[model samples]
Target: MSTTPTSTLRFCLRQWSAWAPGLETREAWSGWDGTLPHGDASPKVDAMPAMLRRRADRLGKMTLETLYAPDIAYHGQPLIHASRHGEATRTVPLLQALARDGAVSPQAFSMAVHNATAGLFTIATRTHAPVTAIAAGPETALAGLLEACSQLADGAASVLLCFSDEPLPALYQPYADTAEAPFALTLDLVAGDDFTLGTGAACTEDATPLSLLHFLLGGETALPLSIRGGWQIVRSAM
Candidate 1:
């Protein structure tokens, strides 16, 4: 016996932005507070949340009511939230307090979890829709994409996929590596598209500083293409 294929999911890129530590992200984007060990370090660290807030604003007018609304309509659909090193900056301070014999703030500890972003998003949008947060070290982006596709395959009417990452803290500067700018994308599956999705594994030879797979397909809307090398997150676009 053969099984019937599931309905195809269509993703539309609604909003996206690539942010660096010191770079001006948006009019409302704010920077982090603190000095860096290196003069060339990105100075816009504190502004990450503001940038995300701004993105949310541009997508649609965000009100206090809408920010905390429980209906899924505000989010367009259910969501899949992904981050590489989620709230690492936030975690650093908690660790410091533990070392200094300072009482760790419960609020801070709660916010430092991997799913904090998704939780905050739910609070901001008041959407009760199901949300899944994923962290797969260096493969964070690909894992997120695959999970979103899986939700679609599982019969979700639609799904929103978001990806973001920040630079490692100065205390952890020795491990500071890679040049990934924080970014987010919201994809909605729709009917009528000639796209196909598949996966494979192999080493990549691309000389780009960060993963090329992310750069090419890290948005809500993008065309499909043949991708070779490395473990890739694949999505077919019609």
Candidate 2:
């Protein structure tokens, strides 16, 4: 419950793009009522080259679509891609194939790794900028955001932060503890003081990527998060 500005992390959001079923537009997402929508919501990924698009799974497509969305103008900024479960849907099947048939396709094995989507993005865009992939349980989004902000503080002009997750397939649904839909969010962030992330009161609310998106969308003045030792994001005082 310590609200100190001295240790606050500060940054400015240049632009953001989010994609989900029936919530592709900011106007549509403004109506989100804390309930994730249910539907196909698969990303088109038409911007990706044909070969890459064919190789990308649903989650990969979602991530690429958000990063390449019309609103996001990528200028080779370093990328930090985060997901609580990176390509889980793809990995599970690979595991099953190994268990059942005692072997799996080598090509599929390559894409089943945690950094597949990030690698695909770099290959597609031919970006030489550094790329970092992260997976930190439920704190995945916060970890990615913090990394981007730290890059800015370390002399980087800007950073591209992306988070993507989809509902676990039916086989793993029973083990799921949190509610989520097929969604991806991309943020173009630069050095500034428009917002602050600092220590905050403890609460039960989880700091899911969707929660961060709502705060960025101006739906809330302060985002209360109970992860990573209790944190919050708010507009810096003028």
Candidate 3:
């Protein structure tokens, strides 16, 4: 009856940033008590170009806000963007328009893809490095972390791993298996011994993007993430 994880991954966390309604500051997030705030307010995107900001949806704005946070010094490292539902707001509307009127705005169609926000981020920052988009249902964050570690193992110096998602549109709310709120979090990961990832028993809590943030901020020894069969990240004892 051994339940300990057999496989493990170790990595360093250089810098981190997170954004959500009423929890935009490090102080606010540090005091988070597992309660999510309700709001339509999205993160500010003034750092992005006017054109890019104008074209970006709410999720895109959140991504830009977290990525370009003044607190973190992001210098165009390779990026891994993960989301459970990418561009659902835009994609859902496009699908509805297509079904109802047989017409979809070309602009909307272009931005409906999962990589649209990633593309926008790179364009805004003028980062020519590789950017990978990941959508692995509930395992999106885990997948993004693995991808970042893989790149580090392949000789990259650093990688920016960002997890961003929002509540699905009202049309798909009924199909939602778990409640979600709008949030974006980024961790600048490098090669070091800051944390370890491994498998464990399933978790019953709401394992949304914010959960990862809480785990990192709360100083927990291990976070039992409800991902894949089950996965967890343990802060390194070193």
Model 3 clash tally? 0
* Clashes, model 1: 17
State every prediction's TM-score relative to the real structure. 0.60, 0.93, 0.91
Q: Residue-wise lDDT of candidate 2 within 19-101, one digit each (tens)? A: 88888777787677657766786878889899988898888888989988888998888999999888888888899999999
Which window of 10 residues has the lowest lDDT sum in candidate 3? 1-10
**Over 4 Å off in model 3, which ranges?**
1-4, 200-206, 227-229
Candidate 1 local lDDT, 1-238, one digit each (tens):
1111233333333333333334323321223221221222332223235544443321121111122223223444777766667677778899999999867989768767876656656665566888787876666555665676677767765666655554567787688555544333333333323333333333343222124223343432222222342333234443
lDDT of 3: 0.81
Q: After superposition, how far is residue 47 of candidate 3 from its true place, in Å?
A: 1.1
TM-score of 3: 0.91
Give the lowest summed-lDDT range of ten residues in model 2.
Answer: 1-10
By TM-score, the better pick of 2 and 3 is: 2
The residue-by-residue lDDT of candidate 3 on 1-238, one tens digit each, is: 2345678666888889888888888788778897876678887688888988888888888888988888667787788899999899888888989999999999889888888888988887777879899998876767787788888878888899999888989999999987788888898888877787777657665356677777777777877765456777778664
RMSD for all candidates, in order, please: 9.2, 1.8, 2.0
Measured by TM-score, the strongest candidate is 2
* Superposed model 2: Cα runs more than 4 Å off: 1-6
TM-score for candidate 2, please give it: 0.93
Count of steric clashes across candidates, in order: 17, 0, 0
